[model samples]
Target chain A: MPFRHLLLSLACFIVFSCKNETTPAPSKATSQRPDPHSLADPFNDKMLELQLKLKVDFDKKILSGSASWSFDRKEKTNEIIFDTDNLTNRKSDPWERRNPNHLYARTP
Target chain B: MTLGKEETPTTFTLEPRDSILGSALRIKLSPNTNYLTIHYSTLPEAAALGWMDASMTAGKKRPFLFTQGQAILSRTWFPCVDSPSSRFTYAAEIETPDGMMALMSAKNPQQVSPDGMYKFEMDKPVPPYLVALAVGDISFQPIGKRTGIYAEPSMLKKAAWEFADMEKMVETAEGLYGPYDWGRYDVLVLPTGFPFGGMENPILTFATPTVITGDRSLVSLVAHELAHSWSGNLVTNATWDDFWMNEGFTVYFERRIMEALYGAEYVEMLAQLEFWELEDEVRAFGEKNPDTHLKGNLKGRNPDDGVGDIAYQKGASFLLMLERLTDRNKWDEFLKNWFQANKFTSKTTEDFLAYLKTDYLEKHGLTANVDEWVYGPGIPANCPRPNSTKLAIAEKAATNIVNAIPATKEWTPHEWVHFVRNLPKKTTVETLKKLDSQFNLTNSGNAEIRCAWYDTAIRRGYVKEILPQVEEFLVGIGRRRFLMPVYTALKETGHVEDARRIFTKAKPGYHAVSYGSIEQLLK
Candidate 1:
């Protein structure tokens, strides 16, 4: 499969006719989350794998299970963070939000 | 059933985080602790789980339990790093009540287990948002070799009949892109109040029964969800910011599938309607609203807030423009290979741009206003204008309606929607009555056309006569797409009391998601 000559030329023509506002070929860090939505820094110790087992309790409308999360440490660290609760869960579940950084003081 | 903050497990802690709805669990890293585990149970009011009693189901004798994890709700159902970026393989053994069946977004069982314990497995890794579960007194009948339908016994035959083209849709999509990587594509026709139109849960697509209109006019939604098998379930957008990566690609692919099955003119009607929807939404969002951008800013806001017609329509329009830029043959090749190359991985908008440049643009000696399309606010000026010769005929007929002319007869629901959309503002009560008598739109069985006519009726201040029909439609269906505008229209037209009364009646049937959206609107 290939691009036809006439169409390819037409595409290039449109590009040159434009204001040429295309930014320089995006750098390696082209993918960005300057203001990241996630609180957990997956990079510090990347989660390599996970296994979850849950039982649905229809009467009580609860699912009870344990999730086994496996990850690798990028560098030796005394502690790690896992983002686990949602603040909007005020109505559904009983939980509270403290901070985005360390939920509690990191220990060595 | 909730995990207390103070009672943190020795291995990790489930604590709250600011700037969002859900909480994150922090687990301490240990050399010996290669796998850390947390035992958690979902609350009855868990966001992901929708527990419907026998009264709420089609069978009216069996309970149904389903999970919706999109945007960020999986954590409420099960303990995991509930993020769209974290892809993981999972297996589950759900213990259902006797005479029930359980299904997951995985390899599923065709029959109900004797003891009610059903097991499921998914070897391919998927984000938490794609995780889904449905349990009920459901039965399945194969529609094609690798396609089928699953519904409660009452809806089984009807659902199978409606989605009879499931096998052909898969073959058409595969012919355009690549083979259907997921083993089988099945659909679970959920009850009326199942919230969204469809959730692209890997092997089985959780769909609203609203799509079972008997006429198959709305099966395009099924095509849209099926296209997700490649765009979303296979090559995924790494973050919610690049949501258009998932939706935009899927919408574009969905249309092509529809075009394959029902010709370009049929698909063009939808594209034109999407353009109209996008225009209205952009204006509603205040053309410059950051929410109107393809790459959305959901910072400190629920990611779901970024979704609207903007993601689906705008994103699709941008891709449509690109396809026209280099022609279909080359564009199909680009997308087909792109899916093949990036299958089963999470990618960002930047990664897509890089791939688009080197793989297609540079290779084909082509360039597009990529930044203007993805990064800019509102619909890009260059978004392709959708036109259909067949739709033009309908549009002409619709245009004549304002001048005492009735809309064309024997029209598809799509054509009715187009006519309803083009109805002149301040159309007199006389005109509404005329259209109603001529079309019987209020009595129409089709939900889409019914809602479309209802919108006009409400705005024309002629809703009082059709009050029963209006209330029934409102209480019967819980699709937020249909619910929001009608409720808003009622609320704005000094009918707050009526809207509240109807919503109150419909509250129990509404999914948590639908309830949340309607509550915010009627608030």
Candidate 2:
């Protein structure tokens, strides 16, 4: 009975310590630590079909293109991720920032 | 952009994937996400795309833009699985000015239409490296039934004449290999400073104007790219480590194509040139240098670092030795079968060895030290030597020059390659002048011969009379094959000031591929 109580107390201490730990918010300054699941492509979860519509502006030296990717889901997964750097509405190249929903996390 | 299973819009981020290469993407999506749309643009400094203004082009009226996607640079231009292992068919819709036309490594439209938007389709599933695009005031001229050449309106006729034998070359290649899988093989002669000699983009080859020497002497560049249709475009290397699989096989096949069109002796001269360059590279990178290995360990490094003479010369030499070991007919048959089997698939060094073992060594009782050839640090001891009997004549003539015995001679491009390559290292300026007067090498239209002469002059400090011509050649052409040795020789001979001056003028015109190396060299 005493051993079981001690074990329960130790588990409680570990849980309490873990609960006190906090994760820093994601930022533009990328973390040096690599993500465990980071890979060349995230589209491998399903068979995919892609379409891209692009326009070149010589004066500005920018190539703006619209990419559409359609995938057929096969498994039971909540979220699917793709690799992107300058494709979002964050900064430079200004990707439809006039609208809302611009929350992104540096996947480290 | 639409995001997840509910078709809701969201954002994404780029995560650092590998250390040396570019980044990867991470986007969150819903479980049943059928489609995600992204509106994107490439920056002006995008590594894969090169934009040349009107001033930089032959036709100063229309601007030029082109895309180079090989060796993982494609990711910088756009987002995708930018690896050689990932392949998918693509179609492009490019909008250009009314007078200009856009072309890709795909089925190109025949004539210019009222709408400036050019639509191109590539049915073949190719890796990102092969997705090439070039847009400019381009015109095409038919050489033979299935072969043609494309260039600016001013240079079209000359390019057509220079590549008159394209059809014959293609037929000869088909006769050796199986068939010309890519329909309507065409050539695009970019501006004078179009980086490489020839890029093996499928359906169309992007070539440099330096190869249009009027004498058709440098058409070997064409042969090399045609050979790539089988080795690189059809059967590709999965990563840069197995680069020799693309180049070595292409070099061997290139020599065969040359031998079929031209004579054996002509190919022999070219082989001798390859030998000298390989020796120079092996000396530069010591015999024990890991970079000397055919199947290189190029992880976490610039893939371009592996683009050296070892993969080209030593790789071809290994295959040549294997050919010498087996019967000629059987070797040809094996190569034909190999190409047909691995068509449109990516391969690794290990995969090739397994094929060789199962397909040839075990079955036909053939033998080769496959590990020593591919995985070892240097050239194998038993590498088959290339013979250039005509080069022997040139060597004899070169020896005769030092002895003050002038032998009367008629020189072709092959002989010039041999004579210049065999020139005495310590030949005085006066001697070069005498040879230059006799052969007119300083004024030679051939880029290879001119490069050889400039390399010699740079080493010997005979810059008095040749400086003007050398400077012109240096600033005019941006091919690393021609520029690298000259700049190295200049630096070695204590002419950093002169090399820097020329590179300053030339750097703006060079593609990023050539610019990156020369920038470091001049620095």
Candidate 3:
């Protein structure tokens, strides 16, 4: 009884909607103005590669190493990145730029 | 429900969008993907190595690599959002040695690759705290049909043999709550250096070596972490501000499980010990910050740091009071319903209280402002105080135990030996003397009380008389059952030798209750 409204609506929608026929089309004015800023989700596609690794040795009482990571961001956008204050830039070879502030930043 | 949708990179334009809240650029998301990734690491510090593990007395820094060891440090082991609301499924593939086994937050471990790599996939959405990885020379022993795996070469057989009861424990939990969505469970014992004793990473758990007392009697830590699968891993705190959502509930559930498995008296004794632990911390000298106590400011108090007595004590106490406020029979049902509605999602103090009010107190024929009691701190001054009469009786018994020393008007070597064997049920001199004649009490005496007696005993020639017990006392004080008294005695005596022994034997234990004293003593 407490969820009567939700249950009633769901039941009616399921029973009536399943009877399938010609669907009503949106009006011309309403259909023409689509929102442009709506963006697609980022996690789709196997484009970027991600890997998390660990190295620990108890015999030597050693727990040390860096998390090896390699990924290619096809493009850039404002994403809530995972960054750490402890990261050190070891090397970029001959020439490489660094964006240590962003966890989701692209390699340069 | 379908959560967030992904989009193609080309779906949005190249231009950046402006926002009032600092930088605002919308991502062109994709529809196919339903996951997120986090990375962590650490930089060099001069005193790091010494602080990570200290052999010296005073100035020592030991080097520690939280994620660097597990290779998750690149993303900082903490959840990226700084909130528990951000829960996501993760799959990790570590390129480690073929000999070394790497444990991840995986429900299932896929086959080891021909290239000598392993890929582990975790199906449940887990918080960062619950996302753990351990790389070590380890092996596994499976427990029956349901409980999938337990990895620890040294203690694998012990862990398997000990936790054989876990399948039933989980079933009991499910019968009380609901079916545990995560199919199977296991525990991975990490090396001694692992900071925390146990990380309840859903199906897989990372435990500390220090906790595995070869006899495996102290397997309750396993129960506690397993309880978190429902209390924390299933439904998490939305923000660190609501740490109780995870810890408090877990403590409550852990106590219940312990009570069910190990008898109510043992659990009650454990609860009493937990209460005393909180009492000691609150009473620590110079710990004047009311905010630090339980009431003042909750902001900036890191989730990990706040796991001190405040979370364990205040949090568990809060849930106990909630149970008192509602019907006992209905409480379990309410929790199950709450989990059914909110599992695998982040929640706040207010959110939990609201549900409690609606589904519990109100429905159970009770009228109380539950929020005021919980969100407020230091306990209601007017709340029912513990029975002082009972406390007085116990105090009297304890005092008698303390005063009952039988050797030489002061502690002597022979007397010390007897005292350890005939340790007082309560601290009293008579109790200490009763065992002095026949048994080697030196080996059996509680560390805390002996330490308490150290100063007086030293003044009364007790230290010189029973120097060996003082040494043995320091080493034997690791048990939680005797830590409080031993700590008090140590503080009182200030004996350098005794202090050194504390350091030598200060191995962190499995229970959160055990670690409090060792870490505090180290500090």
Q: Pick the lDDT winner.
A: 1
After superposition, the stretches of candidate 2 with alpha carbons farther than 4 Å from their true spots are A1-39, A42-50, A70-97, A100-108, B1-7, B16-19, B31-35, B405-409
TM-score of 3: 0.64
Report the C-alpha lDDT of model 2 over B366-461, residue by residue, as the tens digit: 888888888787767998777777778888877666777345556677787677767777777788788788878898988888988888766766
> What's the lDDT for all of these models?
0.76, 0.74, 0.47
**Highest-DockQ candidate:** 2
Candidate 2, residue A14: Cα displacement in angstroms equals: 41
- Candidate 3's C-alpha runs over 4 A off are A1-81, A90-108, B1-79, B108-116, B148-151, B209-217, B282-296, B381-398, B402-492, B496-523
lDDT of candidate 1 at residue B82, scale 0 to 100: 53
Off by over 4 Å in 1: A1-35, A44-49, A76-80, A86-108, B1-11, B17-21, B402-408
**lDDT tens digits by residue: candidate 1, B444-491:** 878898888778778878878998998988888878888888888899
Query: CAPRI band of model 1?
Result: incorrect
Query: What is the DockQ for all candidates, taken in turn?
Result: 0.14, 0.15, 0.06
**Regarding DockQ, does 1 or 3 come out ahead?**
1
Candidate 2 DockQ category?
Answer: incorrect
Task: Give candidate 1's whole-model lDDT.
Answer: 0.76
